[model samples]
Target: MSISDAKVDVVKDLKSEDAKWVKIQKVFYKDPNGKARDWEFASRQTRVEGSELDGVGILAILEKPTGPEVLLQRQFRPPVNGVVIEFPAGLLDKNETAEQCAERELLEETGYIGKAFSSSPIAFCDPGFCNTNLKLVQVSIDLNDPRNVNPKQQLEDGEFIENFTVPLKEFPEKLEALVSAGYILDARVQNIAAGIIVARKYSL
Candidate 1:
């Protein structure tokens, strides 16, 4: 059944303090060993009724004479207290498809407009910690396009995202450099970087 068609009645309100984006709840479910257990988990309470995925992550690439370059963002996450290298991403708006969200977020955060070529299967950010999930979208940006010549970001207030590009061949080195410079790497970024290295090595 679709999310809109499903019934979701809150049995009880378990929070002492209300959070703007998330809610924690105590739940009972069957364990792997076939036993009943109680557990506490976080849910993204802002999800729209008809939305299938929680968010979208853009894997934007630009082709240059040297090689293909990947677009990345450097932002300071309050939870981590350090700058993190991450893909341009955003929570899906109501009734928005993953591809649409990818295109919009990429342009908003990086000032680069891209065409979404493909999308990955829906994946979870942290299944153990929360129900936050996202679909990774493959986007291509044409440097020859006039619109990208002098693009400008449309970031919201309080958002501080720096956009940068790294050659695909030098992605591993870039990750190392970011780490050595005390920047945290998002897991999705690290995995995609590794995939790029492998694809290059195998000529994929």
Candidate 2:
């Protein structure tokens, strides 16, 4: 089934015990003036010991004669109740580094096997609402590679993602078009487009 047909029937609060990936808690802390305060926030429950990262986002770049094409996907996000465009991403497996997780997730979600070279520092997503942190990994995909020709996705059960590519230079314009077409852009996806705009404007 396509994400366009996905629907949510009801929404309800879930207890921390019933949650498999995340939990909510109110943390009490002392402010600068010794004032006691409590902050309610959500955090992941599956972090590997000694690891500060929760997940990795793959910034896959396909080498094309025209220009670099960024791999992106569209999926139904229950929180937003809409088909959202986002980069291929997933939580880290046991003992998996950010680069390793990025490569695995990229192949699973998009069917393109690529090599990860660089990664961003741990970046928090909606720090005010959750303690989820992830790294943006840059992966290089050589379309001329024999394996990349007609690659097939290996999504897990319940995953329904549609992958597509947009030229890097035209990503911002594509984002505008997608927004006008009633598709939600994930915050990280939007930020990448904004970064492209700023970089071009400043000749970076």
For residue 141, give model 2's deviation from the true position in Å.
0.2
Supply the TM-score for candidate 1: 0.88
Model 2 TM-score is: 0.97
lDDT of 2 at 103: 91
Candidate 2's residue-wise lDDT over 34-111, tens digit each? Answer: 999999999999888889999998899999999999999999999899999999999998888899999999888888
Please give the distance, in angstroms, between residue 64's alpha carbon in candidate 1 and its true position after superposition.
1.4
Backbone clashes under 3 angstroms, per model: 0, 0
For all candidates in order, the CA lDDT equals: 0.86, 0.93
Off by over 4 Å in 2: none
Candidate 2: pairs in clash: none
lDDT of 1 by residue, 85-150 (tens): 999999898878999999999989988889999999999888888889999999999989999998
Clash count, candidate 1: 0
Query: Model 2 has how many clashing residue pairs?
Result: 0
